[model samples]
Target: MNAILTVLEIVAPVFLVGGVGFAWVKAGFEYRIQFVTRLAMTLAVPCLIFTALMKTEADLATLGTLAVAGSLGYFVIGLAAWVILRLAGLDMRTYLAPFIFGNTGNLGIPLCFFAFGQVGLEAAVVMLAVSAIWSFTIGIWMVAGKGSGGKILKEPMIAATLLGALFLWQGWETPRFLTNTLDLIGQMAIPLMLITLGVAVARLTPGRITTALWLSVVKLAICTAVGWAVGTAFGLTGAIFGVLVLELATPVAVTAYLLAEKYEADSNAVAGYVMVSTLTCVIGLPLILGFLL
Candidate 1:
């Protein structure tokens, strides 16, 4: 009971924050969501990635495991999603991106923090960073028809990952002042994202709920099964095990919808999947945690 409540306590705010954002837009406070999301993408998200990579200690071997496992897990599930989506005749960018790109960074990071404290947080941070790079580079090819040279060149997440990798190779110690500033900015990403989600929810029409539920089930059930199998087979233990499953089991990211919207993909399908997956996490994450924890 306590565990359940703890999970709820952490998760409920995401919905609540998202609901507020949705309501504001419906009530004519439209500009706030855009402003917050842009701030998160341009400043806070980069800061978060930089600070997390700079601060987390890395062993080449373990980092390799994390990268391999995380990437493989994503690839397996993402491939499955593509097959299912294609068979179901839902082969649009809107539908596919959410299925492929689950909420790895935002919800996944915080959940890892709760599940494993610093150790889990450390593992998740590395995986999230890696996954973010994967989404824009390899992942863009999978979803967006053909990858655009301009899109790849201009992506901030890609730039951040490359710079982080370079710094890692060079053994650079992040300056204290820069780290502090980035930490402050990075702190804003999660809440702002949640609020933006709320605003999106508020704008949901009456007919959207059914599709959301279907995608939610696919996102949670398929990914969780695949993740657990991979983690257990790989003999992942403790926080590493938990982080792998939970992050994979996370809902479809709202950014899938945003990207779909920006790229003129199937935004409606992406939005439906994101909403459904987010709601499904309320039920799915607790169940996974209950069994594992």
Candidate 2:
């Protein structure tokens, strides 16, 4: 009961926010949805990353584990997805983005907090940092056509992660004011992401639902099974293990769609994949808890 309520508590608001956005779009207020999403992607998301890094005190060894595990997890899933889609004769450009991008950023982090508290959040940050690096670099290169130059340069998120790692390693002091400000901004990330997700759902055309649902099921089933087996085999069955599994189990990431758009792939299909993946995970999350928790 407690677990159910906790999941509902986190997930219900997300559905409601999405429902509201859906209604708004149905009423022809589409522009408002775009505005909100832009705010979340440009401001709230970055703030969330910055604040997480600033406040987290992750150890170098642990961060290394997370980086290696996360990279491995992503690679395995991406390869499997590619093979499956290819076997099905699906358009690589249409389905690849959604398959390549997992929902490690928004839902994964919050679910980690719900499952394992502070330790889970730390693990989540480590995974997020590593995943972000890959998503911008190699992940892009995988989906982008040849000669796209999809290399990740030094960016704010990377800088923040490095500085945060330095602080943790060296015991450096962070200014109180900056810390407080980041905290405030970080707080906005969760709610805003939920709302943005809602807006994205609202804007989705009805034509793509079937494709999205198929992709969602693939994401949930394969990723969860593989994550569970790997995590258990490695004796990682506690908070960190649970968090990693949950992260892997999350739906197609929104960044996948954005990256598709940037790389001139089939962005619409990526969007559909994200939508279906997210909805299915609402059910998939509970199933994961049943197995792991």
lDDT of 1 by residue, 17-114 (tens): 66667677878864566677678777877676666666666554565686788888888987888888778776656576577667776678767776
Worst 10 residues of 1 by lDDT: 200-209
Please identify model 1 stretches exceeding 4 Å from their true place. 26-30, 58-60, 92-94, 165-171, 204-209, 262-264
Residue-wise lDDT of candidate 2 within 1-293, one digit each (tens)? 87677667655665566566557667876456557666655566566665665556555675666567767777888889889988888887667656765767666776776566767767776777777777676666667854332344445555656766777677775688977877787677666666566666666543377877887887788888777766766666477678778888878877777777787877787777777787788788877866666
Candidate 2: segments with Cα more than 4 A from true spot? 17-43, 146-151, 206-208
The lDDT of each candidate is 0.72, 0.69
**Candidate 2 lDDT (Cα, 0 to 1):** 0.69
The 10-residue segment with the lowest total lDDT in model 2 = 146-155
- Each prediction's total of clashing residue pairs, residues at least 3 apart in sequence or on different chains, is 5, 1
